[model samples]
Target: MVRTAVVNRVQDLWVSLAGVGTGFPTGGVRVVVAPESRLCPPCWAGIVVLGDSGIATAPDAATAGFLRESLTGRPLRSAVEAERWSGERGVVDVLGPASLAYLDESEFRPATSDAGIARLPTGHPALARLVADVSEDDVGESGIDEITSAVFVVRDGAGVAAAAGYRRWPRSVAHLCVLTSARLRGRGLARAVASAAVADALRSQLLPQWRARPEPSRRLARQLGFRELGDQVSIRIAAHQVDSNGDRGQPGGRRP
Candidate 1:
């Protein structure tokens, strides 16, 4: 558990530094694009500034202190604090890693390919809805097409269950996004799909990193060959509704 937490913390720090952390911009708000093996859009590590007072963008108790000092031109106790704070407002951040582990062939099993399992292109319209279903803030877009990454999915007759994808950038990374429908929880679809994704990542010389908010998910990732990195933080804000036209309730105070 500690190992997974450490890996997560390191991943978070790297993402935060790369500007793709939780509170950073996704599509339109990008300031700089950096190398990341993953397809996540480059984001800002510091606070995301807004044009108007719309959402509360304050950092956590720890991050807030760092922000106040940085803005006032005070000495930083550590770089970690500074990385979490900047002039940017309206963005929430979870900083740190959980645990990390390396992959070995013996620890993984090759999953048989299913003809029904098809790779979903990143540009596919179905992707937008899948992302939206998870959370409004979970989706991001980039003008650079090559930077976009996604996975293939397998639908069991009626509902979706398994997904596998990867990003080859600053570092090679694999993504295993699996959700079992109400009727398919006990089956081994997730394991099969996840193993397949990791196998692909290894072939491409990429590191496979898994994200699980709950302990059980973390445990599963370890069992599948991912080791603990560290624990990180993700500060989530309620996503306000955008009008049917996609305009914010308050003019111009939104993260892209």
Candidate 2:
């Protein structure tokens, strides 16, 4: 279980992202017009339900009003739910509904030995080769290329069998990411490299965050002693449904 302090730290991070300092009501949702909010993805809007406190962002006050109207009664499970009540302006290109988790050092189950794990600089040639070895979808899911921290890896004769690292997000969050070769997955390469990465993040005094949509990834995070905190989803809403050129309009294709 995550400690109370650790829990609050995560809460504070979301609150900051939402740009709601003291206005975030207790046990209630705060709908704000913050197009520039770090919380807002490239989509029209996004909402994060963190325990009793929740925040929703919109591009303008009118849009904020719509979000407030739908999100008034209680916290939503995800932005997908927001689509149901959006009327004609339906959501498109929904990003997540992913699980957000955090780690506490006291409960961290670091690997017993780091014998095979090696530390490498960001954007190393071996890392590039490993990225090339994996499927495009796998690389996108892992977000391995965005890593700004030291990468931990387990190597095989071909190249890096598995690699793990973190992207430094806002509020000192070390967003953990792990990727493994399809052929070498059955081995414990992911666990070993990820453990090394998590250890490094904790040592740097950054909060380790794990966001996963896949059960296996969630299981790996749980195995490493990360606590499931909340769910986050981003939805792009349709603006006018079509453009002046009489062309089809995708909701998430262009910012509404």
lDDT tens digits, residue span 59-139, model 2: 665556556655666435533353553443444556666788999899999877899888889988888778888899889
- Candidate maximizing TM-score: 2
Predicted candidate 1 versus true structure: per-residue lDDT over 1-256, tens digit per residue: 2324334444344454443334222211222222231212223222222211001122223323323433343322222232543223433444432233445545664556545666666565544444434433222211112324455566644434545565553434544445433344456665665666677677776666565454655666776866543222323222332333454332111133
Candidate 1 TM-score, C-alpha based: 0.46
Q: Give per-model TM-scores.
A: 0.46, 0.85
RMSD of each: 12.0, 4.8
Rate residue 189 of model 2 by lDDT.
Answer: 82
- Tell me the spans in candidate 1 whose CA falls farther than 4 Å from its real position: 1-106, 109-116, 123-150, 234-256
Specify the poorest-scoring 10-residue window by lDDT in model 2.
Answer: 247-256
The global C-alpha lDDT for each of the candidates, from Candidate 1 onward, is: 0.41, 0.76
* Candidate 2 stretches greater than 4 Å from native: 1-3, 20-24, 78-89, 241-256
lDDT of 1 at 104: 50
